[model samples]
Target: MKNDRGNSSGSKSWGMMALFLITGAVLGGILGEFAANSSFLTGVAPYLVKQFPIFDLPPVTVNLYVIKFVLGFALYPNLMSILGIIAAIVLFRRF
Candidate 1:
C-alpha cells in the first residue's frame, strides 16, 4: 500500500546516497593525487597531501600453504578532498 511505496522509495534513496558517497570519495582521491604531483597547484597541494588517521595500524595478513590474504584500512583526508565530501553531503540533502 502507501507504506510499501514509501519503503521502496527509501531504499532507492539509500542507493542514491551510497552512489554519491562512492563518487565523491573517488573524485576526491583523484584530485588529491593530482595535486600531489602537480607543482602548479602548490598552494593548495599541502592540504591535499595530508593523510588522515595519521597513526599506523598493522594490517591483518594471513598466509596458508596455498593462499594468502591481507586486509588494510585507513582514512586520509586533505582539505579540498574533505570539502568535496561536504559538497556531496550538501547535494544529497538538497536533492
Candidate 2:
C-alpha cells in the first residue's frame, strides 16, 4: 500500500523562507557596505549601498498602571540587498 502522508521531501515551511530571506538581507547589506568602502569596487558602490526606506513605524509607547511597552518597525533596502533577497528565493526553491 502507498503511504497516505503528504510528500515531505520537497516541501519547505514559510518560517524557513523568512529566516533565509532575513539572513540574505543582512549578509547582502554587509557586503554592500564593504563594497562601498572598497576602492576596487568604487564604480559599483553607488548601485549597491544606497538604502531606500520602504517603511518606518515610529516608536510608540503604551503604559498601564504597572507596565509599559514600546514598539517600532522599519525597512530600508538597497539594490544589493534586494538582489540578495532574490538570490535567497532562488536558493530556497532549489533546496
Candidate 3:
C-alpha cells in the first residue's frame, strides 16, 4: 500500500496570501503615517504619505425571496502598501 497525501508546502490557500498582504499593508500604512506625521522621515515622507489610485467598489444591494444583502469593498494603495506587498511576495516565496 502507498501513502496518499498532498504536498504540505504547496497546499497553502489564496486566503492566506490575502490575509498576509492585508495585514502587512495595514501595519506598513500605519507606520508610514506615523512617520510622516512626526516629520522625521521627510525625505521619503512624500512617498509614504501619498496614496495611489484608490479602488472603490460601489455598494451592491440584493433582495432574494425575503432576503436582503448589501456588500462593498475598497482598496487604498500607498507606497508603503506597495512595499508591503513586495515583502509579502518575498515571504510567500520563501515559505
Which candidate gets the maximum TM-score versus the true structure?
2
Candidate that beats the other on TM-score, 2 or 3, i.e. the better one = 2
**Could you tell me how far off, in angstroms, the CA of residue 63 lies in candidate 2 after the best superposition?**
2.0
| Model 2 lowest lDDT segment of ten | 1-10
lDDT of 1 by residue, 20-65 (tens): 8777777887888888889898887877868677455568999996
> What TM-score does each of the candidates earn?
0.65, 0.84, 0.69
The best-first sequence of candidates by TM-score reads 2, 3, 1
Encode model 3's per-residue lDDT on 1-95: one tens digit a residue: 32233445456668878988888788778877887887668887887868876889989999896999999988878888788778887897677
TM-score of model 3 relative to the true fold?
0.69
RMSD of 2: 3.2
What are the RMSDs of all candidates, in order?
Answer: 3.5, 3.2, 4.0
lDDT of 1: 0.74
lDDT of each: 0.74, 0.88, 0.78
Q: Which residue pairs clash in candidate 3?
A: none
At residue 65, candidate 2 shows an lDDT of: 67
Candidate ranking (lDDT, best to worst): 2, 3, 1
